[model samples]
Target: MSADIQKLGEVDRMIHEPARLMVVALLSAVKEADFQYLHRSTGLSKGNLSVHLSKLEEAGYVAIKKTFRGKYPLTICRLTERGREVLENYRKVIRAAL
Candidate 1:
């Protein structure tokens, strides 16, 4: 196998998954987004979104914050510094391959 193939194998699986990729990609572009916004943007069910968020959180790729907007609760998500670097590196690998 070529070195490029091995590099592909080294890709971060956490963000490699399509759904989680979407979540991270969205977070990359924004300062932060709330649960409802992600739900609407990704069109993922609440449970599915929560699951992906949990995985990203576990990987230290994203920060999840719980707060209250008046009488309602809000769950906000944002990319961490590590996450930004990871995403940028991922892009670099892809671009190099191309």
Candidate 2:
């Protein structure tokens, strides 16, 4: 249906991408995750994951914090309220379209 197609179009492009979607979905299941954990889970190269995270951070969908863990650099990522809402909306849109 045209209306269903239109709903698909309304899905958030950011979360729609496969890589970003995987990240967001994983984040949704936890309070937060470190860069290494995400890398292992998603199997994304470090550079690719960093780039995707930067995009999400710029969009205010995710928060990234840099800190030291036992003198080691640590990057933590978490989904923001806006990110949760957008992901929820994205799911609805996809469901409706299907």
Candidate 3:
């Protein structure tokens, strides 16, 4: 295989998936985001978003916090430093491959 094609293999599969990619990209643009905001922004159902968030959390790529906004519960998410590095690398790999 060509060098460019080989670079594709270095892509991070965790962030490469569409839903997680969207969540990561969104988090990259903000300090953090609430569950409802992410839900509306990504158009992902609550369950699906939860699942993806869990995976990201497990991989240490995202940080999730649960707190209360007055009386309402809030789930806030942000990408970690490692997540930022991985995402930047993923972008470079994809760009080189294409």
**Winning model by lDDT:** 3
Q: Write the per-residue lDDT of candidate 1 for residues 4-98, one digit (tens) a residue.
A: 65688778888989999999999999999999999999999999999999999999999999999999999999999999999998877776665
TM-score of model 1 relative to the true fold?
0.93
Worst 10 residues of 3 by lDDT: 89-98
- Native-referenced Cα lDDT, model 1: 0.92
lDDT of each: 0.92, 0.94, 0.95
**Residue-level lDDT for 97 in candidate 2:** 79
Regions more than 4 Å wrong, model 1: none
Off by over 4 Å in 2: none
| lDDT of candidate 3 over 12-87, digit per residue (tens) | 9999999999999999999999999999999999999999999999999999999998999999998999999999
Of the candidates shown, which would achieve the greatest TM-score relative to the real structure?
Answer: 3
Where is the poorest 10-residue window by lDDT in model 1?
1-10
Query: Which residue pairs overlap in candidate 3's backbone?
Result: none
Across 7-86, the per-residue lDDT of candidate 2 in tens digits comes to 88678899899999999999989999999999999999999999999999999999999998898898999999999999
TM-scores for candidates 1 onward, in order: 0.93, 0.94, 0.95
Off by over 4 Å in 3: none
Clash pairs, candidate 1, are none
